[model samples]
Target: MQDTLILKGHILHTPSPTQLVAISHGYIVAVDGVVVYCGKTLPSSYEGLPVVDYGDQLIIPGFVDTHAHAPQYCNRGLGMDKELLPWLETYTFPEETKFNDPEYARLVYSAFVRDLWRHGTTRSILFGTIHKDSTVVLMKLLEEAGLSALVGKVNMDRNSPDFLIETTEQSLADTKAWLEASKSFGPLVKPIITPRFVPSCTSELMRGLGELAKEYDVPVQSHLSENYGEIEWVSALHPESDSYTDVYYEHQLMGQTPTVMAHCIHLSDEEMDRMEETQTMVSHCPYSNVNLSSGIAPIRKLLEHHIPVGLGSDISGGHAVSMAKVLMEAIGLSKMKWVEVDNQYAPLTLREAFYLATKGGGTFFGKVGSFEEGYELDALIIDDTSMFDANERSLEERLERWIYIGDDRHIMKRYVAGRLVEEPK
Candidate 1:
C-alpha cells in the first residue's frame, strides 16, 4: 500500500550536528509516510507526480521535545521562584493531585496537545501523573491530535505527600495495568516507565518498575541530578549507592533498558563514564534549569565524551512549549558556561543547537526529525513573510531569525509521519 506525496519548498535539514543542508525550490518525495527523496530537482521518473508547491516558504524538520510533564501543563510559569524539591512540594504535587478527576485531565490534556501542535512539536517524550486513568486520557488526546509521544504514568511510592503517593503494591499494579492499556493507542502514542526521581520512589518501587520495564520492553524516562538540593537528597536517601545515577543502575533502571534522564547538570566524572558505557541519553533542559536556579548542564563536555544529547521543554518547570525557543535558550546558556567556566566549554552554534532539537532528540524515536531518505517525514512549513525585510536573506538567516523570533503564527502547517495535522478540535 503506497501513498506518495510531493512537496516543493525551500528545504533545510541537519544531516549531522555540524551540517546544515539547504536546497532552494526543493522537492520532497515521500511514500507511505517516509522520505524517499529531498533535493533541488525531482527525478525524471517522478516528473508526472502532482506536487504541492509553497512558492517561497521554508520547510524544515519538526521539533522533538525529549522531556516534559503533561500533568504540569497548567502549572507553567506558576512556581518559577522555587527550586526543584520545594517547587514539587508546593506547586507541582498539589496541581498533579488534581488529576484524580478525569474531567480535569481531559480539559488540561486537550489544551496541552493543541499547544504542542501549535508550536510544531511533532514528537515528544512526556511525563504523566501517577493516576492511570488520567494518563490514559492524555495518550488518547495525543493520538486523536495525530502527535507522537511516549507518555509515562509516573510511579512514586515513598517520600511523597500522602495525597499523591501510592503504596508500593498499588503502584506496581497500576503501572502494569496502564502498560497493558497503552496497547490501545496508535503507533504514535506509547508508554514509558517513569519513576518521579530517586527520592520519591523507594528501592522496592524502583525494582518493581525496572522489572516491568524489562518485561514490557518499553523505554524509561526520569529526572536526574538537576539541582544541588536534589543531588544531596538522593545521596542521603541511597547512602549505599555510589551516586544518584548508581541508585537507578543498581535498581536495574538504566543499563538494562533504553533510558532518558532529564537535567544532567551535575553528573560526576564516574557517572559520566557510566552513562556513556550504558548508552543512556541526556535530555538537556535549559529553561527549567534557569527558572529553578539549577546550574547549567555541561553539554559540550557531554558531547565531547560522545554521549547522546537533546533538548527538552520540561514544561511548567520550563515554562515554554516551543522547542525552537528551547534550542535558542540552549545556545544562550552555553555561551554563559563558556565565559563562566573560562572557555572550558565553547558555546554552541545555531546549527548545533538546531540539531539537538531535531535529530538529536529524534534518535530516541527511530528515524524521526530529519528530511533524509528513509527518515520519517515530520516537518514544519514556515511562512516567514511577516519577518522578511526588503533586503534579501539566505535560507540559513531566515531559519535563524525564525528560531529566535518566530511563533506558531508563522507556522503555516505541520506534518507528522507525512500526514497533515490540523489544529485539534
Candidate 2:
C-alpha cells in the first residue's frame, strides 16, 4: 500500500542557489516518501488525510554531507595545529588504523551515526578505513539508525604507512569483495568508490578501482588539490600529467562516473574547465580549508564556471558535524575570499550557503534537498521557541539565527523519506 503523510509547519527550502521559498503555516504532502505538493494551504485532495501539525516549528530540508571520513569520528578537534599532509600522517592515519578492529568500528560508528542524526544530516557520502569489515559495520549502523548514506571502504595502495596501507592486489580484491557485500544493504545505505586521493594510490590501483567503479556503476569520492604541499607532491609523483586534476582524469576517476572531489582549494583554470566539462561536483569543505591551513577554494569562480558545488563538514580536519555551522563558516569564508581577491568574487549569500547545505549537496543523491514535487521528503522539524525566537521574525531570519546560534537542542524531530527517524540505538 502507498502510505501518505501530510505535515504542516513554517516551511522553508531553496529551489535554486539564490532563491529561498518560504510558506507560513505551509502544508507538505508526501506519498510513499516522495513529495507531491507543498504550498501555503492544504490542497483539498489532502484535506482530512490526517495532518501532522507542527504548529510554529520550522520545517526545512535535511542537510547532506558530501564528504566525511567515518573512521575519523573519534579524531574531531584533535591535531589541528599542523597542515594537511603532516596532520594526516600524525593523527588521521593512526586513528583510521584502529578501525581494523570490528568492535572499535562499531563503538565509534554508533556514536557517529547518532551524531549525524543529532546534526540533522539525513544523508551523507562517507569514507571508511581500508578494513572492509569495519566499513560494512558503518553501513549497517546507518541502516539500523534509519539514515541514508553512500559509505565507501577506502582504498590506498601506495605512499601510506605500512600499518594502514594495502597491497595493490589486496586493495582491489578487498574492494570488489566489499562491493559485493554491500548488496545486502537497503536502498538508503549503499557503497561508493573511494581511492583516498592520488598520492596514496598508484596508477595500477587507480586504474583497477576506476574499472570496478564502472562495472559496479557506483559513484566515486576522493580528495583533490586540497593543499599546496599535496598538489606539489602529486606533481612530483606524476611528472607527465599536466596538472593535479589531470592525474585523476587520466586514471578515469573523475569523468568516467559520478564523482565528488573534496577540498579543491587550488584548482587551476584547466582543471576547472575539465571539471565543468565532466560535470564533477566539488565538495567545498570550508572549515577544513582553514583548519588545515589549506587555502580557501575559489567557490564563486567554480560556480561561475558552472561546476556543481556542495558543502562538506570534513570532520576531524573541520572539527564539527553540524551542516548549519558549516554553511555559516562557508559564508564567512566567502566574505574573506572576496576581501582577499579585491572583490572579484562576491561573497555567498545566506540563501546560497543554505542551498549548498540543502539542494546543492543533495543533488548528489537525486531529487533530494527541497520541497519541490518529486523530491524525497527528508526534513528537520525545529522548535526554536526556546532560543529566544520572536513572533515577528520572518522564517528566513529565524533560520539565519538558528544557523548562527542554534544547536541540536533546537531540533525537535527529523524525517527521512517521509518517515520519522527516531534516535539511533
Candidate 3:
C-alpha cells in the first residue's frame, strides 16, 4: 500500500473558482489529501501516518507555466536590449543551435529542470531545441527530476539560421519519431507540436503536424501575434489566409487538439472569437513582451471573451523562471496597458493574477491548481515567518505578498501527487 502523508497549511485550492483544501496520499484522496477513517477527529487508524504541519504558511498548487523555451535557459538575459527578430537572429538562433551537441544539451537541460524546481513550478509546457537528441535529453532530465511537463521538438523549415533549419519532410519525420519515442515515458512528460511559428513552418508542415495532433490526441503549442513585424511577416507569407490566427485554423491546428498560443498581443475581434470558440489557451508573457517591446497582450479582452489565459515566463525572452515575478509583472504590465492604451482595459486585480498563475493555468491538467476534494496533491509549502507579526494579514494578503515580494526562499517543501519531491537546500 502507498504510504499516506498528511500536510497541513493554509491551502489555496483552485477548485471551481478557488479555495483552500486540507491535503493527503499520492493522490488528494480526501479534502486537501486527508482521509477520514472515523469522524471529523483524527482517526486512530491514521495514527501511524506522518503529518507535516506548516503553521500559517500558504500552500498552493504548484505553479503551472503554460509557455517557455527550456532550451533557451542558457541565453537568458543576454539579448534583452534587442527586439524580437534581431534578438532571434543574433542570440536566440545561435544559442539553440548549440543544443545539437548532446553533451551540452544534458548540461543545460539539468540546470533548467533544477531551476524549475527551485522556482516552485511543478508543471509546464516547454519548447526544446530542433535536434532530436537534445529534445530527448530534456525529457530525460524532467523525468528524473519528477516534474510534470509537456516538451516539444521545435519545427522550423524556413526563415531560420541554416544550423537550425530543417527540410520540411525531415522536420515532420523527426517530429513523428520524437512523438513515438516519447510515448513510453508516460503522462509526466508528453510531446507537443511546436512549429516555431507561422513564418517558419510551411502550410504542408503545419497541416501535417495538425494531423499528427489528431492522430496522437496530444496538445500543440506555438507562438502567435507576438510582435508586429512577425505578424506582418506571417500575413505576407500566407496571403490567402484572413489573418495570423486563420493560418493555424486553415491547417486544422486549432480545435481538434488542446492548443496553446503564446502572446496574443495584437489579436483582432475575429481572431479572439475563433480562439474563444475553439477553447484555445493563451500564455501571457509580460516581461518578454516588455523586454522586446512586443506590446502587451490584451489579457482583459481575452478574459472577457472567456478564453483560457495563463502566465508564462518565456525564459530567455522574459529573463526569469519565477512565476511569482511573472505574476507581479503581469499585474504591472496590465496596469500600464490600461493607463497608456485605454482606460477600458483595466489592470488585473491581485486575485485575478494569482488565479491565472495557479488555478487558471492548472486547469490544463484535470483537478490541478486547487486544493478541492479529489484534486491531485501537487503543492508547495511556503515559509513566511520572516514577515509574520502578532497582528497579521489574511490568507489572500499573504498570497499577494508572496507573489510580489517572495522568491524560492519561501518555498520550504514541494510536493507532486502527494509525493515529497524537493525540499529546500
Q: Lowest summed-lDDT stretch of 10 residues in model 2?
A: 383-392
Which of the predicted structures, 2 or 3, would earn the higher TM-score when compared with the native?
2
Q: Taking the tens digit of each residue's C-alpha lDDT, what string does model 1 give over 1-425?
A: 79998999999999899999999999999999999999999999889989999889999999999999988998899978888888999999999999999999999999999999999999999999999999999999999999999999999888899899999999999999999999988899999999999988999999999999999999999999999988998998889999999999999999888899999999999999988988899999999989999999999999988888989999988999999999999999999999987497799999999999999999999998889999999999999999857978999999999999888899999999999999999
Clashing pairs in 3: 13-19, 13-371, 14-370, 22-32, 23-32, 23-33, 24-33
- For every model shown, the clashing-pair count is 0, 0, 7
TM accuracy, model 2: 0.99
Model 3: per-residue lDDT, tens digit, 215-240?
Answer: 88888999999999999999999999
C-alpha RMSD of candidate 1: 0.8
Residue range 143-170, candidate 2, lDDT tens digits = 9999999999999999999899999999
Write down the worst ten-residue block by lDDT for model 3.
Answer: 31-40
Cα miss at 93, model 3 (Å)? 0.2
Candidate 2 accuracy as lDDT: 0.94
Order the candidates by lDDT, highest first. 2, 1, 3
lDDT of 1: 0.94
lDDT of 2 at 9: 97
- Report how far residue 250 has shifted in candidate 1, in Å: 1.2
In order, candidate lDDTs are 0.94, 0.94, 0.83
* Model 3 quality (TM-score): 0.93
